[model samples]
Target chain A: MATKLLSRYPWATSPFVIGAPMRVMSGPALAVAVSRAGGLGFIGPGLKTTDTGVDLEEASSLIDKARASSFKTLSSSSLLPVGVGFQLWSDDLSTAMGTIEKYKPCAVWLFAPKEGQKDLDEWSRRIRAVSPETQIWIQIGSLGEAKSILQSSEKPDVVVVQGTESGGHGRMADGMGIMTLFPEVADTLASSHIPLLAAGGIADGRGVAAALCLGASGVVMGTRFLASSEARISRGYQNEVVRASDGATNTTRTLLYNHLRGTYGWPPEYSPRTIINKSFIEHRAGTPFEELKKRHDEAAKSGDSGWGPDGRLATYAGASIGLIHNVSDAERIVRDVRNDASRRIQGLAAA
Target chain B: MATKLLSRYPWATSPFVIGAPMRVMSGPALAVAVSRAGGLGFIGPGLKTTDTGVDLEEASSLIDKARASSFKTLSSSSLLPVGVGFQLWSDDLSTAMGTIEKYKPCAVWLFAPKEGQKDLDEWSRRIRAVSPETQIWIQIGSLGEAKSILQSSEKPDVVVVQGTESGGHGRMADGMGIMTLFPEVADTLASSHIPLLAAGGIADGRGVAAALCLGASGVVMGTRFLASSEARISRGYQNEVVRASDGATNTTRTLLYNHLRGTYGWPPEYSPRTIINKSFIEHRAGTPFEELKKRHDEAAKSGDSGWGPDGRLATYAGASIGLIHNVSDAERIVRDVRNDASRRIQGLAAA
Candidate 1:
């Protein structure tokens, strides 16, 4: 079953490394770079549904340019090497389906559905109808969600089992860590033929190797990509991710950041993990939401300076940030992780 | 460092499995059974500090009986094969020190210190003074704790980096998953000679292999041992643990059970993860603590019937309870996990 899943992505290597779609930060440049380095990369949800078409067009242009330069990264000419992700709750399906049909990306990663598997089934069926060759990927944080997928009308080609340590949006209260979550999900879906991918707190080769040992066919990295050079992010935010240490103390899963950014309506069960800053500190210190919002808006106008321990802007990241020390390109990050995982696995066997 | 750590326990195999001291549930039989199967086992903290002495005396008698037979688990005459754990916040240090002086256990696993490393340092110094052959093992759930150990007056022989998925008393809010926590702690204490062990949500061989891949010299299992036939646990509790399939939905980290059981004074930063039952559900559903406590006390007299979804007793366990399907003897459990981890690591290398 795992081999069949890997065969679908011919360009990728063993213990596949995936660049998780982290909102707008994971754009065409980052996604293409990861894919080019023998890993799968998916463009994250955009500011607007139509924005996806713009990014896919740019991704297509970049792939064409690479092919023209004899890069030979992607062998399949008919399919775009990169994938695109969507937040099923807020994203427009028609726009996503239209964009998928036009670009024919290799995959469509779906997450945060409002109506659970029902929404996922609708999106998965429509995406397959529009882009027959594109595989469907669904992200789930709980075992119950994995079970629901089995009963759905349309099954996903791959399931991403994210843990509570994941950054950005994740299960609010009931999420289990990947150490237990992935294996349970894998055990339940052992006969389903849907390859399981581990996500959450995977920032380096150690995490990559650990996920593989947990029976993950592959691993996905979201926060690690946020520090990549190709990420569509402000310098301040990247710096915070690099500078941050002790994520258990520095980061938290809260909706205060979302509210401060004027973004709301995420499912009640979902919350984003971010590096705590002045806004959160003040909010917890009894500062009213309105006052914190005013400060956050003021910080947003300060550009890169808005992100830091003292900065008020939200810096979404995973608990693995402490492991990420320096900023590297997406391709190097992928290669380094893959090589490290191989070395660790071999070292254990030798031991 | 890892080799030196393993050499201390010559009878143990690679990927050493430690039966976590699970608050009176892990007794002499379970610890000795695990040790007999080439793994280290720890007696959990008892109802009183002096109770640990009683358990240690029993463990000493059990070891003597094994020694009288053909069993050759512990080659070292000076060091007892089994280990003992203590809750520093409540366990009287004098009583524990006296027990260690008399038994000279192979290791001492210390956790939930109210004064953090200060208490640990005191325990380490006194333990060394009393029994220099015994190793000091400190349990930490965050990187900060790992860092703090570096500055302590006495260093630990082994550091157990436990994730939030751990049951019993763990870091309530700042604890991270072992996937990220272990690696980060390993990176920070790279220069320190303390061998690191991964704990939390680790029920089987998959978790053992995953922990080793994440740079752990060994792994610890608390919740899994709860289902072991040798564990000092009630049949109903073991059945509930085996019956539970989804830790994310079936278990939670809360103080409701603690208060209901009339067990208080756990440090504010620590909480136990337990399988939810009628008492917890009632507390969450607006039933006052007093009312819940009354029902819990009433249910306690029902023996094994006091556990399960409808019962009111606390089923203290990690999130890995879902992965444990059966109650096996401790010796068989240890051997199976060690063999499985070896197979998994080899499988990854082959892949």
Candidate 2:
């Protein structure tokens, strides 16, 4: 399974690291940099369906530049090395398929379907039809979801088992930690020949090594990339990500930020984990939503200042934030994690 | 640190496994069996403080019998090979200390102090005074709790970082997954010389391998031990532990079962994760606690049938229940997990 997964991306190395497509934050620069550094990078879901096409166009240009430069090892396959993610329930299938038809990203990460596997089956079928070479990577949070996928007409080429510690939107009430969740999902889908990737609460090489021990062919990191230099984020939000510690207390799974930002209608079963700020604090302390919304709007107009402990903007992140101490380029992050994981794996073996 | 931890218990092997001292369930037979299997075990807190002394006396007899049999590897340290646990907030310290002084257990596992680290400091100091050879093992659920321990006057010889997915009592709100929590706590207390053990949702070899990769010197199993043939558990309760699946939905952290069992006044920060039963279902579905408690009392008189999907007895188990298929003796369970974990660790290193 590990060899099969690595075969899809020739430039990638072992203990495969992935820069998760973290909504708007994961963009062309980060994706291209990660792939150039022998790791897979994914462009997260954009604000609009057509925005994906724009990111792919930028990614194509970046890859072309990298090929002409030092990164001559970059794959020249018909499908681009970078992948793209979509929020199935909110994203328009036709528009996403159109983008995939054009760029033909190596993988399509499908998540948060309103009708679960049935909805995933439709999107998987459509996306595969549009881009035959592209792999379908479905993200599931629970074992039940994994079982449901097996019953679907279109099975994912890869299953990313996300634990409850994941950032962005995840299973609100039915999520377990990846430590137990991953191995169970792997055991259940062992015969399927689909490679499993562990996601959520993974910030560094220690997490990467741990994930591999849990039977993950690869590991996906969302929060760690939020601190990457290439992330498309506000200065304050980035600083907050760097400053946060003791994630158990600093981060929470809440939808207040989503509503405060006027972004509504996420699937009911999903909610985003974010760094706590004044907006959520006030809301929980008896401030009305309307009043909080007014304060959020005011905070947003103040530029980079709208993203600290006192800031009202949502700082969607994972519980692994405390482990991230500084910002670095995507390439460095990927290489460091890969090297650290290798060292740790070797060290544990010797011990 | 791993070497130091193993040196303290010469009978234990690398990737050390410990049977968690589950309340009443982890008794003399289970503890002695685990120790005999070359894994450390701790007798769980008893119904009363005096009951601990009774369990220890039985454990002494079991060790004597085992030594006369095939288990010649057993240590002859003045302290017993098996450890003992106590719930600080509710337990009488003088009584527990007296028991420890008599048995001289290899370790003392302390948990749920009413005043946090201060309470732990007092217990550690007193336990050390009573039995100097007994190692102090402190269980913490969050990074904040880990940080607080560093400031205490009495330092623990080992710290068990318990994630929220643990069965029995755990942090109600602040607990994060062990995948993230263990590494951060390890990084914070790197120079303390304390061996950090990963707990919560750990059942088999994959979990054990993962914890070792996360820098855990050892791994602890609480819920998994509940299914051991030697456990002091009812047949129905053991059946429920094996029957449960999709722990994300089947298990929850709630105090309803505790309150119904007439076990109250647990510190506000903690709650036990139990298999969902008729008692919890009705309570969540608007059934009054008074009516539920009445039904619970009647169900307790019906023998082992008091546990299951419809049973009202508290089935305190971790989210890893789905992975457990059957009951085995503590020795077999320990040997299987240890051997499997070693195999997986070696396999991952080669990969």
Task: Provide the global lDDT of candidate 1 against the true structure.
Answer: 0.90
lDDT against the true structure, per candidate, is 0.90, 0.90
> Which pairs of residues collide in candidate 2?
none
DockQ of each: 0.86, 0.82
Against the hidden reference, what TM-scores do the models get?
Answer: 0.98, 0.99
Error in Å for residue A185 of model 2 = 1.6
Best by DockQ: 1
lDDT tens digits, residue span B229-301, model 1: 9999899999999998788888888998888777889989899989999998888899988888888999999
Q: Could you give candidate 2's per-residue lDDT for residues A97-198 as a string of tens digits?
A: 999999999999999898889999999999889899899999999888988977777999999999988888898888889988888888788878789999
TM-score of chain A considered alone, across all candidate predictions: 0.98, 0.98
| Cα lDDT tens digits for candidate 2, B56-132 | 99999999888888877775566799999999998899999899998899999999999999999999999999999
Which residue segments of model 1 deviate by more than 4 Å?
A: none
Relative to the unseen true structure, what is the C-alpha lDDT of residue A350 in candidate 2, on a scale of 0 to 100? 80
